[model samples]
Target: MTDIRWTLKSKAETSHVNNLAWDLQVSDEIANLLCQRGIKTFDEARAFFRPNLKDLHNPFLMKDMDSAVARINKAISCGENILVFGDYDVDGTTAVALVSSYLMQFTSNVATYIPDRYVEGYGLSIQGIDFADDNNVSLIIALDCGIKSIEEVAYAARKGIDFIICDHHRPGEQLPEAIAVLDPKRQDCHYPYDELCGCGVGFKLIQALAHGRGQNIEDLLPFLDLVATAIAADIVPVTGENRVLAYFGLEVLNSKPRPGIYALMTFQKKREMTLGDVVFIIAPRINAAGRIRHGQHAVNLLTESDYKNATILAREIEDFNSDRRELDQLIKDEALTQILEKQEEKRFTTVVFNENWHKGVIGIVASRLIETYYRPTLVFTKSGDKLAASARSVKGFDVYNALEACAEYIEQFGGHKYAAGLTLTEAQYPMFKERFEEVVSKTIDPNLLIPEILIDDEIPLSSITPKFYRILKQIAPFGPGNLQPVFISRNVYEIGQAKCVGKDESHLRAVFQQDGSDRFVSIGFGLGKKLDLLANQKRVDIVYSIDENEWNGSVSLQLRIRDIRPSSMG
Candidate 1:
């Protein structure tokens, strides 16, 4: 039932494993994973282990930082009404919260604006501009968006408003004529790291402004919690500057979280938090505000100073998250049924549509669809006169480029390679769907269609110990690029209690062992149906990541099983 291929690193790369192991005094298995992650040298290993705030890149190194800082300072001095505009998603709302909160420290003339998803759609809307105009706002700092809003920026420009854009999205052929466009992705930009999320970009702007004011950049460390959450939720690579930010951000979260974050965690009992915790716990509650109600609720929660007010807002957002879960599951079930009824499972791509589907949860539904029919997928729903859709691609495929190929049928599309959003007239949906399938089937690498589990190393269960796990725990806040290490144990046998557990008996729990090795408990979430694979204590190969499980006031190392099969099948 498992077809995951186990990929090992090149022998040349593996050769450094021993040297790193000797240098760091860690096991060869851990060293192999470190070397594979490009941490071969002692200095690299040190930097990886110690993510210092001093290691962050200079904010002014980004192109246009001087101009952005100068213009913002002028607006603050003159007391010009300044507006912060951003998207409605986690990245956008967090960016708004970050920049607006930072600016309010210097001047009280700042205001934040998040466009309504259903009403104004995405990016620089004319309605947002009109609101700024009515409020006598002379300057707008656009975050997360406005990279491709050439016309919208010009619209604000003609209305006697200047714009400073802090964005990370790819620029269009014709760049917007804003006062300062601060995206590192611009062709002329020489910013070393181009992968900063929207909030990260906003943080850079804050850094530049602080430097301009002769203030210590360390004062801004408190805001890294938001930047870290955005980095995780936005799914940016956890490397270089991003890693540094997240490292300190986790410290901030665990030590002295903002009142808003404190309120969000009021119900959570866990004292220490990781990047994974931010993604699953904090991101969802913040995102729910935008999905079920309005994004401003999230910004309010982030910016609220009073703990009591933030607690009330957090509870409100929690209700929205609960509603989102119900709608998300219902729509996913309906989309699955639609695919089966249409008999389109054999197609190279999944393109499902229903006019009545909730537009708010379509992106989540698109991701869920891939589990049942693994391929590039798009979930479409009627958004007013246009049929808006969310696109999600499997690993190693570029959904953004696929959308570009079908641009003739699309009204607008924008996002990264793995995820994107677009809209088209209802009449063009069928053609767009056909064209997308054709483009993907022709262009996508055949091997990418199958999901893969890239094993970091092969080790005996005996190699795992308390000290090994203690060192592994140092690699906190894991995400893309620097994933948690996964190891394969070959010829392991089920020693005792291999049975289904959890609700609906959907998980497998067992104790596993190999020749002359101590038994290790394991849990295989969603692998209950594969219990037969352990029949009669057959020799098995398991791919798993080590985890600490606490039970009955005791702690022990356990394998969080990724995949398992009989040794013959593996």
Candidate 2:
């Protein structure tokens, strides 16, 4: 049988459940979860439950927002050619789509330029700048990148071209000489919500443009569907204003998705969709463009106005996504094999470099390694003369700062606390890798290296009712920061179990008997391995979320199992 561990909420946090219950008008069970998440005030509770777009922070509050908006408005007025330069990832491509579509209403001079993931790597490039200069593009809007393009921005400025940066990545000690820098993380900024993704920041810029042009904010809500997709795809925190954006965005996704999104959903045979649909069905297709081909295809798909062409493009992207999954799995397997052969000692950190690994999929490989090894991971692949690496870290570890410690060896780097990217000369990879391990070994606490599942709250099987499940559904469209509640049910008896329930062993269907009176059905996706363990156990504890399962013309409340472990059979 597999080992099982139970984690209880701290006593001090649990004690505040009553206060949370009174403040939030929720049951003590939900209050326990809120208290565990450190939500103490009523305002925090309201913000968590009911996020309103009206409460979004002012766009001008971001650093350099005023200058950035002014430059763009001036460009529109003069009808000068402007280029929206974006990264190749989903966040960057969606940022480009949002800003370019909004700007297109004012001038046809605006166009989008997505860097080639295989050829151009990431961020602002001199070749791109020179091309824009050659085309006489006077204004450049850098999205999802350019925070650390001090030299590139300076070079563009020297060519009489102005830049307005709308990046959300971590910044360096010095800022670039851009017309306006609009990152919430800037020290000088006073924006209330700081966890915006690149597309979220782009939406704020559009908000500023609408205000500047005397346009109503309602006109922009439709585009929030794209913003929400970026926020979810980029894995940004969904608290505060992000929650509102994603909430309403999901509505638009289900009701009036753009032609391209509609085509994608049709191709996937998803007639109805929720936020989960965007995460699983839509985001991956958009991401595949950047992973396997030029991200311009994604921008085109997003901007496509014809339904027939959108369908074709959608199918094309679907094929790309299929190919991307295969490539990712192959690379992940190879990388895992290399890690096992080289680092079998299980070092505190994993640093793997393969000359043949696909650079586009390294970040994903790094993330998978971090999930499996429960340690800080850096995956590197050969990129021209330099080695490009993606770094992912556990909570409480600042990966950007960790990269900064080895700045001398890194040619360039940027990102947030948990994820970052860098490039260094091929010759310097060994030294950088060694120094990275040394820094992490010395700086990171040993206890933080192990992975621990954070349980939200415990609920007895008898306490689960249809009304409670409805209340839980209202708080959905969940993501980082705002997460789906994970309820732990202790000492549940296994009444029945079904093997290979879904296609390709996609899921396990089972029934549980609680107190020999209440019966509930559950489905566990990717949890098929736990079926054997459950079959051997007389009683078990399960962690799950309540879901509404729809069958042939019928709907019923069901448990979506997360984890299952044996319980004492007293």
Candidate 3:
């Protein structure tokens, strides 16, 4: 529906692709896509296609793992009350659910804590420490957050409570003085795989404990469903160990999901769950508890053992999700209107603020703005005395670094290259906005402003055989590092009458053939306005990902169209 550049991915080694294709007995297209992902040899391809649990790196390899495990073991032996604390978002709540449940297996003294998004803000909050201290908890296991909570960690220490942190966010220059700080991203850490999400990190800790207890890895299979959801929700790279976790996690998710997950899945049709389904369908509902209510509700539901109770909680969370959706859409429209009213559409970055905006959906609103404005975006709302903002960046640009350049205006901020959050006084908002725009304008690569799609390969309709699709489908659990392949097909002709569908008539449905050799059904969501490309029997080019479409209880291969335009060569 919008202009986009289609670029072929960087070519892989030619000899390697041909040799691998011969060995694998598949098309060169599949081999090339694999090679581009750094899969060269047969062994590498084998491991990639079939991830083994034994392939997972030793849990003890992560820095401070022994210390963290030792402390947790000591607490369980001493019958100490342990507090599990995490952020309010999906990664955090999932981590809390995982670690708290795992610890509960050894002792019943474990308590899970999720900070109030509105009241306590983010990370290791002082109020959470106070709660831990009041409850006679002697140890606190912080998950997903606490990497940058130096003061709060010290605060917990002063209260005679030891801290063990399991986090995946990038560490600050100074590490917290906790009893154990388990973060793969730390500079001194020697963990082989650093891309684990918060829940993945939590998974490693429990894996270490189970090893100490002489528990077989099979005992941990039930927990994979939670790890997979966190990995999907956190948007971590789906390569290396992460893929293995996601693979097995999805297996558990489909086979024997927890009561909480099973309850949530009642809304989805009975089918295998993918990373996309977790991201769009499940994560938001989990996040909605924290956004619209208290994050503790999410932790409650995730750890609920009874299916009927979980269903009751799931029904409540669904209402929260519905409220979240309305808030997101309404805030997005308001933010867009603010941008246009301010005459700032031509700016290098989007900075919009509304004191009346709901703090929960500002991040979603910031993301929606980028789709319309196609630039770095920040959405701000009033948070008590100061103004809190959620920041999102365009592809290939580091919004975190841009915020760093304007650090003088920010009270505190943390996040990755693409997403971040910050707070500042209302008085400094204008300067921060101006300085952020200037920083991004000077530093961002000019080409990153335009959206682009990386095409894996160009192929004719005949290349898509049933066997080919069957093998291609093995590349499951796709995310950032490893993504579902998109292909470009040129000189394709429409074979049937095209029609606009959907409630808004914004969807395109048609059948196309190449050289009259094959006619495959295709559906392009949000491409109805471009139906002119098929008029007068004009040949057109298309960018699409292959998918299975189910209609009338029958399933067939279909091209999920990404974009379509008149053939450039013809």
Q: Per-model C-alpha lDDT, please?
A: 0.90, 0.84, 0.91
Query: Across residues 334-443, which tens digit of lDDT does each residue of candidate 1 receive?
Result: 99899889998788899999999888889999998888788999999998899999999999999999999999999999999999999999999889999999999999
TM-score winner: 3
The model with the greater lDDT, 2 or 3, is 3
> How many pairs in model 3 have backbone atoms within 3 A of each other, for residues 3 or more apart or on separate chains, i.e. clashes?
0
Residue-level error in angstroms, candidate 2, position 129 = 0.8
Alpha-carbon TM-score of each model against the true structure: 0.98, 0.94, 0.98
- TM-score, cand. 2: 0.94
Q: How well does model 3 score by local distance difference test?
A: 0.91
Which regions of candidate 2 are displaced past 4 Å? 1-6, 11-26, 34-48, 343-345, 498-507
Best by lDDT: 3
Q: Please write out the lDDT profile of model 3 over residues 31-97, one tens digit for every residue.
A: 9999998999899999999999998889999999999999999999999999999999999999899
lDDT tens digits by residue: candidate 2, 1-570: 123334555533655778878876778776766666667778777776676777877788777788888888899999999999999888998899999999999999987899888778899989889989999999999999998899999999999999999988877789999888898988888888888999999999999989888877688887987888898888888777888888888878888888998999888788877767787888888988988888999999998889999999998999899988888889888878887788543677888888888887888888888767877889999888888999999877888888889898899888878888888998898898889888888999876776545567777888788777776776777787867877778888877665647667867788876784468888888788878878788889888888888889888888888878888544
